[model samples]
Target: MPKLISQINQLQQLGLNAKEGVVYQPSRGFFKIVYQGLILPNLPAPLRYFNYISLVGQPRIPLCYNAHTITTSAIDTATVLVSNSQHSVGHLKTYSIRRQCQFDSEQYKFDKTDLIEWKIPKIHLQRLDLEMGCNLTIHISENISNNSALQWGVSDYWSTLCLCEGEVFYKGQKYQVEGLGRFRHARALHLPFLSLCFYTCQIINLNETTQLAFSQIRNQWNIILCSRLDIQEFGKPVESFTEDVNLHIHRVYPKVRTPNGKEMYLPREFSWQCKKNGKIIFELYAQSRGDYKFGLAAGYVGSFQYQLSWNEQCLQGEGGYCEYIDCRPLRWQEKNQDEKILDKLMLLQPCLYKK
Candidate 1:
């Protein structure tokens, strides 16, 4: 833990950044506050040296959530921003938090003695009072498979940076579409992102009944998010630079990811699904992005998860191809590098983005 703090102290020297905060994001639904950005160990600043720490977490429920997270820096007496939802990572969920840190006598220590934690209460999406998105008249099935033999399709616009089509495995085979949406990763998380394979953050029913997969597709070039909610990605204009974001669900059908690996295809097709009285009038498809291929990077969940972590760290410029940090900081190298504060801070930013 002291090592984690030492590393964090080295990072605060920098002005802006983000990182993976916990050793592992709680798998069964839990929140972790990663201590990042600390002033130089021997600071000569006139006033209190302050920095921001972020918490990256997801909700365990199949519903939208209202989550609150409070973190006391490894260094005590720091006042923090407690404004983001630390829950419901899938839809209308929030990385939604921003806090101010002010240090006191015991600044380097976490308040766990008194237990500063994330309080999560499950909220069902069925309880959401608002409609999710532009309703599709498409009829889905109990099994969620295309009973009508609906080959996957995508709709794209040049103005929309998204390729309008992406693919993943469904029932042991790869399914292709003009554009399928699900949670991906940061811009660096492209094509070989996660060891060159597809990854998802969660899968749940909007009303807690129908099941679907949620993945994140980021507009790599712009760094804006193109989120995947309910199998299909919503074509929304989003600014990734902002502190707010939203994702919706597809409640009409059950989305599926095949086991094994059967391959799907794309046609030089232009099509669309229309309804006069809420029904498909004809098969609608647009010029799809050239067909592409993707699936498991190469392993089971456990092996893949670790690989992703190592990849994230590497991209973020941290050493140690593998390290699980939980409130515990890395040891200062004391190498001739001389321990720059910005370097230390950057190390933590890649762990978990604290909003």
Candidate 2:
């Protein structure tokens, strides 16, 4: 395939730099954005965002907003937020936010709400609802960025894959939304609770331009340092699989409970496969779609119903969006004593017990 579209246009030109923006560099960086189903039309209900602006190590409230309205079963009423204000990420043509990143306090009052504006390939988010109304906006209008953008390892992981189109204005009516979404800006030399490990991801759309994204990062003795799978399928280009993929994680019972109450256990099924030298290039399977969105970053966000298979073709994805992040060390959700002395000084870092 033209040498895989010239190696995905040389890894999307070493991933991002069309005037790169959104500051980083003063403590393990981070900048994220995620949208699932871009803005779909399939029986409404599939709008997501797992926003973040962390700079890792430097602490002090670093934005984490989490949007909602999902399904595979259910998930709504969500618009979580967190911030330390000081402008939550901005640049790259207004990389994000415009007003009230948060501040009215006397125990939270928040006034002007929110705003995001990018111009290239048009994007325009809005958020308002602390009684200020207007609640949603979204509007994509193109939002390019593809070739499964990459850049990896040693934690300087960059990412990209966008293909949206837009129209969404709930609470005042408006529909139209496209598919496939994800964009990341990274830099993390450590701190995932100092590498105790666990992270998972999925983003499947399978219809109007087939899509399927994958992610995995284990460690804490479970190995599997990283894994990625891209796919896309419409214009025919993206199809990157890293380390031949493997992923697994099956029927973990019902447990749940987080919001600091800590409980754990989730994964009512999962699968992954991919190979090259000895054949078999695809496989996937999913299940649990009963709604979940626990304290985010600490872990939880769910919805699934997939069934991919490649070479003999078989795609069936009725809503997909998954995430399961558990970077260990929740020493009872550390009620800060300087985070339990920085979790005993990152448990005497030995790279968290050898990877």
Candidate 3:
């Protein structure tokens, strides 16, 4: 077995040997633990989508954040990795988080000047078996680049690992709950009014020997910013590069109410084509199986669990699609006669409309 796989199994077996601690209540019903650590060594560099400051202008700074999760059914193990930081002209709000269990609890606070470090915590999941659940926490830290023009805020830097003991389906195959499932996301934040950004990422596990990850980002007006694709085989990097890319939304979920009662639309299915140096490389199609919603500073974003199939060159796998769009600009209310007249006047003047 790979060293990484062996280490994960040893950690997971600790859950079976250890006693359960006081239950930790997550913001949601599921149990969650946020810690920082280097779970994998010699991983590929992350794809940079856009720099908020460079694109939008200064005093608009860039922030960067990264989150990664890995799971395996063969050994019933799950792991999460995360790192986040920011550079800005002035201090923003101080962020803090507190999680308590019967025997242990943790509180973290981040200020403007302090560079936040990743925390790794040792955690134990209770009743981790078929139809049972398990939880564990550990602390880990690593040196990462802080020079990106994009930075994710302090509060957004943490990662959560949720484990449920049950039977889950993947690629129409049934396996005992041991190991082999994963989900991950990372982002950089900036003022909503300053600019608009769109990004899509997908990972396809072709088989035990190969995997592919791809992403593309667009600006507010839907102009392409950058795109990247990376390929790996047997846990070793094979190829990685930036390319011209296009993504098409084939199905949309329509507007749905958020927790705060605001409405947003999300894509449920999409297809993409990627090209390198003017040569078409691959085409991919993906459809969502379900959606998960989470809150953000500007608004709520939704992520869809998805299954993806690509050209034979790329293979097929399952993953997720997430979207974040501020609805304030799109929101409209009833207009009176005067407002309607103004609207018509603006429409009649092409120059004014352009302005």
Best TM-score goes to which candidate? 3
Model 1 Cα shift for residue 212 (angstroms): 5.9
lDDT of 3 by residue, 214-304 (tens): 6665443444455666565542323655656666666566567644344545556777677777877777776654433332322322223
Could you give candidate 2's per-residue lDDT for residues 93-150 as a string of tens digits? Answer: 1112113223111111123444434443343444453321222223222322331223
Each prediction's Cα lDDT score? Answer: 0.19, 0.45, 0.32
Model 2 C-alpha lDDT versus the unseen true structure: 0.45
- On lDDT, the candidate that comes out on top is 2
Worst 10 residues of 1 by lDDT: 319-328
Tens digits of per-residue lDDT for model 1, 1-355: 5544432333222111212111211211221222221110101111101111222221221110112221332211222211111111211212222233222322222232111222111100111112111101111111111111101211001111112122222223332323211211111000111111112222211121222332333211212232332322233322121112222211111212222232211122212222235543222112212211111121111000110111123211111011000110112111112344446667884567789
Residue ranges of candidate 2 with Cα displaced over 4 Å = 1-76, 81-113, 118-212, 215-228, 231-236, 240-246, 250-256, 259-263, 266-273, 276-293, 296-322, 325-355
Q: Which model is ahead, 1 or 3, in terms of lDDT?
A: 3
Report per-prediction Cα RMSD to one decimal.
Answer: 26.0, 21.1, 17.7
- Tell me model 1's lDDT, rounded to 2 decimals: 0.19
